[model samples]
Every structure is written in C-alpha cells, then in structure tokens.
Target chain A: MTAQPDQRITISVDAMGGDKGPATVISGMAKSAEKNPELGYILHGPEDELREMIARRRGGQMLLDRISFRDARDVVTMEDKPSHVVRHGKGTSMWSTLESVRLGEAHGAVSCGNTGALMALSMMRLRKLPGVTRPAIAILWPSRNPQGFNVMLDVGADVRADATDLLQFALMGASYARNGLDLPRPRIGLLNVGTEEHKGRSELKKAHEMIESFADRANFEFVGFVEGGDIPGNRTDVIITDGFTGNVAIKTGEGTASLIGDLLREAFRYSPLSRIASVLALTSLKRLQKRIDPRRVNGGVFLGLNGTVVKSHGGADDTGVSAAIKLAFQLAKSDFSEKLAARVASTVELAQDEVHFASATQEKQEGS
Target chain B: MTAQPDQRITISVDAMGGDKGPATVISGMAKSAEKNPELGYILHGPEDELREMIARRRGGQMLLDRISFRDARDVVTMEDKPSHVVRHGKGTSMWSTLESVRLGEAHGAVSCGNTGALMALSMMRLRKLPGVTRPAIAILWPSRNPQGFNVMLDVGADVRADATDLLQFALMGASYARNGLDLPRPRIGLLNVGTEEHKGRSELKKAHEMIESFADRANFEFVGFVEGGDIPGNRTDVIITDGFTGNVAIKTGEGTASLIGDLLREAFRYSPLSRIASVLALTSLKRLQKRIDPRRVNGGVFLGLNGTVVKSHGGADDTGVSAAIKLAFQLAKSDFSEKLAARVASTVELAQDEVHFASATQEKQEGS
Candidate 1:
C-alpha cells in the first residue's frame, strides 16, 4: 500500500482508452519511457491490439521491457449508462486499468475516455475516503496569481451535493495543492454568486459557513467566495464548487479560450496585408498561444479516493496522451496518497458527525 | 399603448445612470443619438453635467429640442441595497426615468446604475403580464447556430424560484423571442443537468415535463432539456433557468470570454516577432474581437413585465453606457412590451391551466 522513498513508480494506462485507442497511447508511452528511464508502464487492454500498436511505434526490444500488457475487452462509450459501465464492464480496459491501481500493481492509472463512467468505476472499485461521501475531480489551471497553478475541484464527479461534500472537496484539493503541485498551503476560495456572504444560493451560503467553521481541518487558507472572473484572473490558488457549476465553468473556460484562439487565427487570415503581418508576427503569437494551451495541462486528477487517477481529454491524440502519462507518472512518483490520507485522517473522527449535524440543521431550517 | 408602424420610437436616457453619473451617460447618449438620427433622445439627468460633457465632446445642440432633462437629487450606487433604492430613493434618477416608460413618455428607459433596483421598480410600476408570476432578465449572446441569438433568462433577477417560476420564465423568454427579436416561434430549452427525462434536480425535472405537456398552450418549441454548454454554443435560442444558475453561467461566459481575449492579447505581446505579425493581423483581429466584446452586447432586457427596462453594465464607462443606451432605444423603438403582451395573451389561458394541472400531477406522483 506504500512505496519506499527511492522506489520506482509504475503507471497503468488504458491503452485502448481514447478515440485512437491503444495505437496512439502506446506511441506516446514508448516515447515517454525513453525519456523517463525509471518509469514503468503497464498497458492494460486487448493483447493483440496492444502488441500490434506497441510494435508499430517500438524503438526496438530494448524499450519493450519498460511496458507490460494485460488483456481487457469491453470499452465504455460516452453514451453508456454509468451503472452498466461499472457493473457489466468489470473486465473492460478502463476497469482493469483502474483495478491495477487499486491492487497496487500500479501507483496510478490514466484513461482518456468517458468521464462519468471512469468516475463511477473508480469510486466503486477503489472506494471513497472514510469521511468522503462523494469524490471530486480536481484540475490545476495555470493562473495569473503568484502561484503558478490554481487547483479547482468538483469539476464533474458529483452534480448535486451537500455542504459536507463541498468541505470534503476542499480538503481533497488542499491535499492536492501540497502533495501533487507542492504548494505550502493552498489559498482556497469557494465559487459563489458574488464575493459577499449574502451572495450565492442557500446551499452555497450554508456551505460557506461550514468551510469557515472547519477551516483548520482542510489546512488551507479559506479566502472566502470568489467570482467566475477571478478564476482566470489568478486571484486565488484554489476554487471549490459543486460539481454542476464547476463542470460548466471549466468547460466554458476551455471552450471560450479555444474560440478566442480560432478567432485570432481568422483575424490574421483576414486580408493579404493582415496575413503578411501575421506571418511577420507568427513567432510571438505562437509563444502567446502556447501559454494557454490546455494540452500543456492535459489531465485532471480524480481526488479524494483510494488511489490516483488521471482523466485525459477524450479526444486527445498522441502528444496529449504523452502529456497525460507524464502527469500521471509525476503524481504517482510524488507523496500524493500519503499526504492526502494524512490530511483527510487528521479530522476523520469528527468528519461524519459534523456533516450530519450541518445537514440536519439545514433541513430543520428549510422545513421550518 | 402602441406606436404606429411608421412612427419613430423615442427613448429617454437617464443621463446620470452609471457609476460615473451624468457625464458618461450623456456622452454615451450623444454618441448613440448621432449614430441613429431617427431615434429621438430625451436626456433626463442633471442639466449641467449633460451640457458640460456634451460640450467637451464637441457635440452640437442640433437635437436640443428633442432632448429634455428631469433633474433628480440622488443616484443609486452599485453597492446600494435593492430594497433601499426602491423604498427611499423615490425621486432618484432610476425611478424617475422608469416613470417615463411607465407613463409612456418614452418607449423604453435605459439605466446603468442599480440593475436590481431598476428591475424591481419596473416590476412595481409597469406590472407583470396578467398571467405571469416572476419576470426575468433576458440577455442575448452571439452564437454559432444559424438560427437565432441565445436568450438566457433570469440572469440575476429572481434569486429563488419554484417550478412554476421557471415555467413562467420559459413563456416570457418565448414571448420576447417571437415579438422583440422577431423569431416566429422561438424554441425554449430548459437548462438542466442532462437531456434525459429524469435528469437534473427534482424541481427542474418537474418543470421539464410541465413545459413538454404544455406544448398545446405554449406557442414555442419545447426542445426538452439542454446542458449548460448548449446555452452559449448557439444550440438553442431560448434557455430558461432560475436566476442562480443562469446568472452564474452568463457571468462565467462573459468573464471567461474576456479573460481569453486578455490572454490572447498577452499571447501576441510575448515577443517582438509576434508583435509585428499582430500589427498586420490587427484590423481583422479587431473586427472579430468586436464581435465578442462585452461592451457591445452589454445591455440586458428585463422581460415579462408591463414595460421595457434595459439593465446596463454596473461598471460601464462612457462608451459602454452609450452602447446600452442605443440598445435600449432600439428595443423601445421596436415596442418590445406590446409585442410581448400580444404574444403572451394568446397563450396565457393555456399556460395557466397547464401549470395548475402540472402541480397537481406532481403532488400525486410525489405522494405515491
């Protein structure tokens, strides 16, 4: 269940995870393995497909030992039922890959596929932390703040949640800040309708009180409510929210940024003069575009669970898949789970009692 | 209260209705008036502030006869409580300006100060459409769909709403679409967790069914449920939700869009090589940027009320204020309210009956 300080980290990848399946994943893994000598990769998917893909991208037999393959058949689609994905697809590529992490055959798992199914399967297999009713997906966004990255949690794992769930997400995100990203103490801000206490919905208002009251347990600076503008503005190191809003906000941010980039490209293509100018400025513009490319931060960590899981972009190609594998390896090599567990365990005894008390109090208030 | 088809619609600008008060509002009004000569303007803020600002901007008093001033002692602040602004500030610029619309002195009233207070006063004075419960604030966003502008209602007006309230928002949005925006039969989509029948919170689920079953009475297309991204991507013309989610989504989109624009500029500024290219690309980039500028589409129309009240940007300066004034005048000249009323009247009886029947059916289901 634990790794020694000098032990090499192993990662299990669902090679058949993305749109291009094992071929693109193996190509990326082969390239990454050459770069990271100490890293080990377990490619879990159909035997023939994994072997064929690996052979196509192989540098030779010398690099072949760095990867080992396992057979897994079923593939979960975006339209698949979450329950069905978790129940019927136990022997599937995604499920077997996640099980490797749970069984400690791998330090972490990476899947570039259906987000909902992955979350459900991971939760069912690895189980949620003791005080955690529902886990959250935490993403580190490159921020303008003094901190290089701001960790935002509950991206899409749980849609409707209570105050306790939000508190748990904050705890998990703070742990991630320290262990995964190596921040001293992440400054956490709850996403709200406004900065004021009187802002946001009744649920958020209630969650704010719990976050403030239990501030020390999470071991992060509770910086109060942050607005949507504050996310990209880099005013805070961590933003916490319910899954629905968080998912929408993240997707919107991604979509808008892409739209702007496309618009800029079109703008440079407008006229002959503009095109010539764009060609002249291409170097500077390219640097600028690279600064916010989501591909640079290609994976979201599914936090507050038993083991680390990195969810890559469903449409990611070889380069993006490589980035995700690198990220997952980095997470596994770090003291992520230990630090996360200590943070969660620090307040474990009273976590459930507090949650119950808060929920009861809220229910009484609403009922009255 | 309708103008002749050939009559030129007039709008009165509360030339003191923004953060900077009269100087900026007047400047904006003057610019908008110059752009559209057929649109008559009546400036109703402090006379001296308007005169000084207009003179400074080299605007001639050519339209002096068309403009009028109604002096008010106080102006609302962005920080002021909505209730306090409504109760104590009877003679405030916002109240007096809205009075002009109520009494038909102007077809529409534009105010950049105290959006909540403006909406409240409009509701109190102009009154709601006979069968409507809660009025909503509808803002149009540019979309990729070839069909129509995306209308997100309850942007920040009603904080808490029931199933019936959302249903009313749907009707109001559809009416506004058909009459004001000139969509023959607007398609209404409920913003929910998913497109599934059982998706989203219980309240949204009930509202979805009510909307679907009420298709007999509702003139618009009820396209079932839609996810958040669908709202801004131009998938649906009319998106209905309670104020909480709608406000969050709109703010997220606006802030994120602006943030991306800022990042894009920063991207181009990264190096001298790109700077030259950016210069060549400037004109086309500017054209595209204008297409998504927060300032150009800053005005939000408050719908379902008896009169048209346009809410301007809280932080609006002269140019943004001017854009809001122009938008308000255009909507007023269009006589949005009369059009909305006629549209709502034809479907009111059917909508009301469906709503009652829905609640009863829901209660029976819940009991079982």
Candidate 2:
C-alpha cells in the first residue's frame, strides 16, 4: 500500500470556500503541484465548475491528471455559524474535504472557509483524540529565534481555557514545534503580563506549576513566564496561552506590521529624493518583506484532533493558499496528527497525576 | 486660589523613581519648562541631589526659580511588590509625589516607577472616585485616526474586568478621548476576537449591549465589536477591554514594531547601495519615525481616581519623560480630573438604571 514511488501525497482542499472562489484555489493547487512534484489534491466543490476552471488553465491536463474531484453541492459562506454548519453542512465542500481525511482518502485537509465552521466540522468529523479536552489552533510567528519562527497555540479555537487546558496546549505546542519546526525539545513559555512570578491570573500561576512539574517528563524546557514582548523574542521557541489572548496578540502584531508597512510606503513616496532612494533600496526592502511575509507562514494547524486540518486566511489569494497547501503537505508527509496523538496519550497519566497532586497539596495547605 | 499672572501650572514629579535617575527627570522638567514658560514643578527626591543636579544645568537659575523640592529619604525599587510598597513606602519619592496632588499643592502627579506600586499607592493615596470600583490605565496608540492616536484603557491596571467594569472603562475611556484627543464624539468599540455579535466571551457580549445602550447618553458612537486589528485602525477612537487583554495587545504591538524597526535598520545596512539610499531617504524615514514615535505618546493616565496620575515608562529617557510631562501639563491645565469626575457622576444613575434593567430583562427571559 505504501510502495508507489510516482503516487503523490494527497491534500483535501475545500475549493469553494475562499474569497476568490474556486479559480484561486485551483491556481494555488497548480502552483503547489509545480513546486512540489510529490503533492496531489482531492478537490471538493461542484464537480462541473471546478473541472471547467482547471481545464481552462495552461497546465490544465497535468493538474487534472493529479487531481480528483468530489462533487459537493453546497458551499459554506463566511457568515455561516459553527452550530448551523455542524447541523446542516454535510453537502458542503468544507464537510466533504474533512470527510476525505476522516475516511483516510487524503492525508490532511485544507480550508479557507469560516474559521468557526471549519473548526466545528473538523471536531465533529475527526473527533478529539483520547484525553484531549479542547483542540487548539497553532500558528507560526516570525521571531528572533534561530529557527526564524516561534509556534503559538490556541490562536482562536475557543474564547476560554482553564489551567488544565493551558497545560495541554503546552504539550501539544511543543509537539508541533518538534514535528513542524524540527526542534527536538522546544522551549515553552506561558504568556503573562509580566515575567515576574507574582504577576498574572491565578489560573496562570496554577498552569505555571503544572507545566514546570511536567517539563522534564515531557522532554521540553519550560521557561517560567514570558511577557507579550517575548513572543517575538529569542527567549523561547513556543508560546502557550489561552485562545482569547493568543488570538488578540497575533492580530495586534499583524495590525502593527501592516501600519508600519503603510508608513514605509508613504515614507518612500514623500519626495522626489526619497522616491529615487526607493529604487536603490528595492532589493533590501524586498529582503525584509520576504523575512516577515505573512503568506509564507499562512496556515493555522488545528491540533489535538484525530486528523490534521490547516485553516488558511479567508481572504487569502493564490499565493497565500499555496503556502497553506504546502504546510498541509509537510504535516501529512510527517504524519503529524498521529505523532501528536501519541504524544498526548503518553502524557495523560502524568497530567492526571499532577492535577491530583496539586489538589491534594491545596487541601493540605487549607487543612493546616 | 486663582493663579497669578506670573504663576504657572505646577506638576508633582517623582524625581527618584525612573531607571534613568533624578537627573533625567530634572532634565525632562527643564526641557518642558523651557518650551512652556507658564509651567512649574514640585520635584520630589533628596533635597541635596536635586539642588546639585538643577544647579549643574546651563539655565540652572531659571530652572531653580521655577522648581521647589520635597525631601524623601526612600526610593521604590522596580522589584518592590505593590503590597510591600503600600505598607512601607511612606518615605519614598513616589509617595511624596502623590501627596502633593492629594494636598492640592499640584495640579497632577507623574511617576516613572513600577506600575503596580504606583497604581497601589495611587489608589491608597488619591483614592478611587465615588462610583468607581476599579481604576483603569489608559494609553494612546498610534493610529490612522485624525487625532493620530486611539485611546485604549485598562491596559494593565488590574488583570480582570467584568461586564460592569468594562462599562465603566468605556465611560472613562471616552472621557479621556474627549479631553486627550479633542474628539467631541469619540467612536468606541469593544475589543473581541471578531466583530460578530455572537463572538467572544459572555462578558464581552454583555459589555457590548451595555455600551450600545449607553452610547447616545454617553455622547459616543458605539461601533459595536472590533477585532484586535482595529486597535490601530481609524474605525474606532477608543478600544475598551479588560486589563489582561489590553496589556498583552499593547505589548505585542510594541514588540512587532521593534522587530520591524530592527529589520528596517538591517535592510538599510545590507549593501553599499542600500546605505547610500538610506542617506537619501533619511528625512523620509525620520518623518515616519516621528509619526509613530513611542516617546511622543509616553504616558498612561490612571483614570477613575480622585486626582490625575500619569505613569511614564520605567525605562523612559529625557525625551520620553518630557512627553509624559507635557501630557501631565495639558491634563492639569484643562482640569481633566475634575471634568472626568463630573462626567462619571452624571452617568452613575444611568449606569445603575441600565444594570437594573438588564437583570430584569434576563429574569423575564429565563422565566419565559
């Protein structure tokens, strides 16, 4: 079953969910296929439209040969609620895309649909792995680390996560760093308002003790507490926080970057001399852009689930979509989902032991 | 007593608190005094050092004439806990600084010390204004708005904020915007993961409804919910959230900006041609830097207190301290604390009525 050298690793793509529709998704697939010969697609959409769009392309036949179409009649809109989608989205491309992964027909799934709906459908179809309470969405942030990026988790999966959930995120995030970024024992840090031990919420304090107790057993270094400024700093390789804080931090970073970019553009256009200088500095500026380009690290991988799912930006263009597909391909090739599940399963007993020990200690302190 | 024709608005300065020491604080005061002839200072520190530093300056006589000294034997270190400071910090310069404001000896107080200690001392000394449960720290963020900055509150005053606290932050933030940014009708937005009504925590949803209901009475346009990206965008003049989220967001923004600045510097130094180009674009880059300079917006005003207290950055230099002093001078001259108190007092009854109405509606819905 595994010996066909010419057979490419397949990625299930919800072709109808993005802002630019099926054309951009197909163009992205084509772009990825050209770049990586080992990649193929399980295209989910209305079969006729998708086939027609692919057939109209320059390398249509080659793309058509590698791609297989699944006829999904319905499309999930950006406005669709997660509950509504889970209840009635079976005929949608997003549902079909995850179905391919669930049925083992594709290695991983990719979608640019509504994030909530995508996560909901993913949880429903693939289900959580044993001992996993809440699945998290992990994304890569450009950083001063030697690896050039740091992994941050619980980006926007849920608005709440308790101390136990944060512990799980730390375990899962460290695993992702190992598999995705090739770090053997990634250093993890809990995000707080300050680096001081006395700062942040009570739950953070609990999580800190729990994470520290398990760091040696888990085979990752736990750097006690990290402030938001340390997210892009070189002190740690993985940042663990609740979804609400992580989501806001990432978006704030994006907004600030966008503002700086706009200001840089305005600066270049300010005067004739500056405009002339822009020409000479074009190469240098492009180098900087490439280093921090959001598209290059475009996917948010849904972790702690039975299957791997990458959620691309809703308004993603072809290049952005291509980056997401590339991420999916890498995860699928590495069997990331299975490895992550194994990591969580192996540590469940240790996690439970820590929780019980913590309560017992609290009880003793109160009794005293 | 009314100020005489030659008399100036006086500010209480915690001269010994910042990382740069009392010399930088005095330099900042002198700089502010040079530009503002109608400004004076009540400098708090050891009398001998203060006099020596002032006498060593170029315009020492003029600075000496405008300054008065208060002898304080102790200093609040950055590592001191708020509780410890509250108990044993009576002899510190920070305490002396707030004392001037409490005794009506100065119009406002400014400190460049530990934020938590300053806040604890401020609450203990200045006291919370009537009807205020939790005081907030509001800072200005560079933005696309006409005013060039947006006001965000509860940046790090306290870690938690309930729905009621959020409503108060909204009122206080809007008041700050009106006085700080001169926006007669500031547009306020609740910070959340998404703009959708159904998104975010239950507290955010409750705050959203409460803010909306009070918008007309509060004289602000409620923009409903705004994501983190809108914090710097022109869409909202005030972004309201709990202290934990706001603190993380602002720090993340700063970290991202610092990363881009470093990258830009590296880009300019990449090659000889790029270096030459940087020389030509120097003026344009400086213009951009000036627009988003953190030094220009260097103070976090503690709102919901009996008197004005501006917290400058702990690591602020002379220019940064000067900017903070300028902010304090402006707030003191405009009688911002009194105006804000009046605004809060006027809306207290309305707030109580809305809270009652909300609970009644909830009870009715639950019964149905």
Candidate 3:
C-alpha cells in the first residue's frame, strides 16, 4: 500500500461516475490529455464501455495510447451512503480508482462521485499520514486576493476538528497554497466570529496559539483570526477552519455566486433593448463568466492522506471534469502529498519544542 | 432594569455612533420618523452636538419635534474592547441607548458602534431572559425565500452554543422571524455540515432532537439540518447556528456578493461597446442593485435579551441607518421582546418535560 512519490506519474480517473455517466468523463479526460502532453490515465470502469465512449469523444488518437484500463464491476450511485459504500464497495469504480493511488499505480485519483463515499473510501484505503489526526478537504475559492483564489480546507472531510486538528489543517492548507497556488509564504488566517483575540470557541483560541507557535518554522505568516468576509478578499491566502465551518462556507459561496449568476442573466434579457445590450456585451460577459466560473476551479484536493485525491463536483460537465483532471495532473507532477505529510510532521515537532521551551523558561523563573 | 412590554414604544438612538458621527444617525431617524407618524425617538449622545447635527440635517419640523434628547458625554469607539466597555461604559451613548430600553423609555435601541461592545453592553445591562444561557445577534440576509430574506441568528452574539443553547437559538430565531420577518410560522433549520441525520457535530444532532420535540408547541416547522447554501435559498425561513458559524457564514455571503458585484461592474465597463450596453441596461442594473442592497436590510437584532437592540453597521450611511431604525420600529410595535422572553421560557419548559419523561422511562425500566 506504499509507493514512492516518483512512481505516481499516471492520474487515475473514475470513468463511470458523475451525472453525465462515462461520456462526459471520457470527454473531459480527452480534453485534459490534449492539453497536458505527458498526462496519462488509468481509466476505471468496465473496459469495453469506456473504450467505446473515449473513441466517440476522441480529440486525438495519439492521446488514446496514453490511457490504460482498469475494469471495475460497480459504480457508486449518488443515493449510496458512505457507510454502505465502506461495507459493500469492493468492486465499485470509486474503490478501485483510489486503490490505484494506494497501490502506486497512479500518483493521484480524480473522481466525480458521492463526496461522502469518496471521502470514506479514500480514508479507509489511503489511511492518514504520520502525525495527522484527520485528513482535510481543501478547495480553491475565487477571491480578490493577489493569487486570484484562497485555499480553504476541511470542507467536508469530517464534521468536527479539535484544536490539534485545526493546527494540522493550517499547516496542510499552507503547504497546499505553496504547491497549489504557488504562494511561497502564504498568510494563514483562522476563521472566527470576530477578528478579536478573545472571540470564537476555545478550540480556536488553542488552535491560534498552536498555529502561531509553529508559524515561523512552517514558513507561513499567521495573520491571526479573520472573519468570513476575508475569504473572498486579499486578507489571507489560506483560511483554516474545522470541516463543518469550511463545508458551510464553500457551499454558501457557491450558492451566492450561482444566485447572482442567474439574476444577472435574467437582468440582461429583461427586455428586447436589454437583449440587444447583452449581445453587444457578450464578449465581456464571457470574460466575466470565465473569471468566476466554478468549473474553472472545479477540484477539491484531499490533503493529509498518504496519497492525493481530487474530487470534482458531482454535477460537473466536460469543462468542469477537465478542470478537475488538470488539478489532479498538477498535484501528480509534484511530490505534493509527501510534502504535505512532511509539513504536518514538522509542525507537530515544532509545537512540542515550544511547549518544552516554555516549561524550561518557567523553571528558570522559579530558580531565580 | 425590568420593564413591561406595554411601556416599550419609543426607539432609542445612539447619535454619536457610526463612521459618519451624528450626521447620518440623525438623518436616518428623520427618515424613519417621517414614514411612521407614531414613531418617536429618545436620542442618546452629547446634547449640543446632536442638536447641532439635527439642525443641519433636519428633514421636517414635525420630525424634529418628535425627537427627544438624552444628554450623554461618552461615545464608544470601534477600537474599544467589549470587556473594557462593560467596565467603563456608564456614560457612553451606546450604553445609554440600551439603558433606555432597559428603563422602558424605549422598546428597542439602535446603535452603529462596535458589535462586540454593543453586544456585551446589551448582555450586561438588559440581561439574559429566564432560561436563556446566551443572547444571539440575528440579521436579515438577502434570500430567494418567499419573504425575500431569511433570519439567521447567533451571527456574533457569542462564539459558542451548546445543544440547549442552539435549541434556544431555534426558538428565539423562530420568534424573531415571526415578528421581524413577519412570517407567521417560519420553518427553522439547524445549520450543519450536511443535511443527513448522521452528519455534523454531536451538539447539532442533540439540538435537532431538542428542537424537533417542541416544533408543534412552538408552532414552527422544523426543517432539520440545513447547509450554508440554504441561507439564501427558499428551503427554510430561519437558519440557526452557533454565533461563530453564523458570523462566518454571513460575512462569507457578504464577501461573495461584494466580489460578484465588483466583477459585474468590471464586466459592464470592459469595453466601449459594453459601456454602451451598460447605458442601455442601466435601469435593469439599478433594479438588481436595489434587490441586493445591504443598506435596505441593515441591522443585526440582538436576541435572547430582556430588551431588543438593533446594531447598525459601523460604516452605514443614512439609508442603512434608516433601515436599522425601521426594523427597531417594527419589532417595538409587536411587543417582540416580551414574546421572545415567553418563547424561551416555554421552550425551556418543554425541554424539562422531555428530560423528566426520559428519566421516568428509565425508572420504570429499572423497576421492571
């Protein structure tokens, strides 16, 4: 179940997944394969069906040779529970998809399936890294930041995170920003009720202290606590919160953006005059769409696992799927998972150092 | 500090608060006073400064005559800590403003000072109602619900809420929705990471059970758990969460909305052609802006206290300040504070009844 980060070049794709079935998934892989020349896929699902679908949606025959087939007998449905999946998911494409990462056949796995099932199966199979209590699901949110997006984690990995788990989330999130967003020294902010030090849960206070103690050694700046309003702004590059808060925040952002998008479309076509105006501004509108499109930033990276897993939205189309593949491809290229594991390990060591140094200082004070 | 709901009518104003000083607060009062003939103000701030500002921004002679001044020397600054304000806030306008509510001189108080300071002072002076562990700050958020907005509570009252505290939030939020949002029977949803019964924090699960037990008696539909995306959608009228989560959800919503708004503006003016389109669709754009304007729905009502306190944003202008005053006016007319107190008392009773019944069952089982 162990593999060197170097042997993980191929990206595994769950082929018979998502709402659109194999057609959209193959189309998406073809799209990513066309763009990323070195990209290869260990396509999961019934082999004959996938080959047919990929040929139908083929961008180029040369790209087809890069694909290898892994036949899976079952597909995880949207209605399936995570508990059910964990018990009865032996031959499912999702199980086999992540199994490729665990067994070193692929560097990372990409799936457009039930999030709960994917997370459960991934956790069960990949297992948590050393010094990692709980793995986190980190997503890149569109923002007004210098990097154009902010990284938020524990989106829905687990419902609760203790103080130490939060500190680990901070370390993992910062590492993701460095590798994913390419930010050298990301500013990490703990999400809270208020920016004040005394505000929020005691867990956050403990997390704040823990994260700050390791901030210097972790190579990230601790921006202290940030309000939710800072998520889409340039206040911090990484937002660290428990899975419960992170899950709600991302969904709320998506819902708000979707609502605005619908309203804007209705506004632009409210009348014949407005319709003509929309036609005139079509190019500008498309640019705006591209800038804020959920599909463009479609992947949520599962951090703190032994291997990386990228989850595309369940309802993603070909464009969205391609974006998810692209993310998986990027993470697969770098030793991102190993680096994340190392970051978490070092942060824990640094925290223990701070505690040891503090006790020593207290002894010195008493001696004097 | 105890006053009957009958003695609550006049709206108290903290005139020296907000970024615009006394000018906007005075103007906002003038605006609200003009619309509601029965509405009266108990102005709290420096006497001479408020009088001078009133003279400068006087809307009508009738509005001016309706205003009654309460002279005070201190003004709470944004930099002031909540703890510090609680200690040395005797003569501050924000304190005096809520004191009016406590003294039955006003039914509700409106202030644009710091939220932490405002919340802390209100909690200290007004005191928590019977069986209420903590007070919650409820705000109206723009939504696609039938009422065009949803009531979300514990936005920044306290950072934590245990199971019982959350059930109290549900009862309080439902009552606020009835009076504030004017929904007779608002459906209440406990905010969680997921809607599944087995998902999220154990406190939420316990809160869900507690709230469900009293739904019929409370006369509100329990919509179970809701995700953050539901805040702006029509799935429920009231979303209840601990203050920490609620505050983050709200600010994140505002941040996302603001981000979309700026990007929309950029899109509309991206080119000369689009500029012409913008000119053509100016009316539609204005309509859209009016629809999502935070100023129109501009106050966070502090609930679970003996008296109502409406906190206007620190930087709110005349329009936003007026919106806060208008909400105070509505809640004051409805005997909301008394009704809220009653609701908490009754819900606490229901919880006790359930606890008693559970113990009785255990006793019977043991005897058998």
Best model number under lDDT: 2
RMSD of each: 4.7, 3.3, 3.1
Q: Which residues of candidate 2, in runs, are more than 4 Å off?
A: A1-7, A352-368, B1-7, B352-368
- Per-residue lDDT of model 1, residues B302-325, tens digit only: 888877778888778767877777
lDDT at position A169, candidate 2: 97
Which candidate do you rate higher for lDDT, 2 or 3? 2
> What is chain B's TM-score across the candidates, in the order shown?
0.90, 0.95, 0.94
TM-score of chain A of 3: 0.94
Among these predictions, the greatest TM-score belongs to 2
Worst 10 residues of 3 chain B by lDDT: B1-10
Q: Give the clashing pairs for model 2.
A: none
Query: What's the TM-score, to 2 decimals, of chain B in model 1?
Result: 0.90
Write the residue-wise lDDT of candidate 2 on A115-227 in tens digits.
99999999999999898999999999999899999999999999999998999999999999999999999999999999999999999999999999889998999998998
Q: Name the fnat for model 3.
A: 0.80
Best by DockQ: 2
Ranking by TM-score: 2, 3, 1
Interface RMSD values for all candidates: 2.1, 0.7, 1.2
Judged by lDDT against the true structure, how good is candidate 3? 0.87
Report the lDDT tens digits of candidate 3 across residue range A46-143. Answer: 98877776666536456578888889989999878999999999999999999898888887899999999999999899998888888889999999
Model 2 achieves a DockQ score of: 0.78
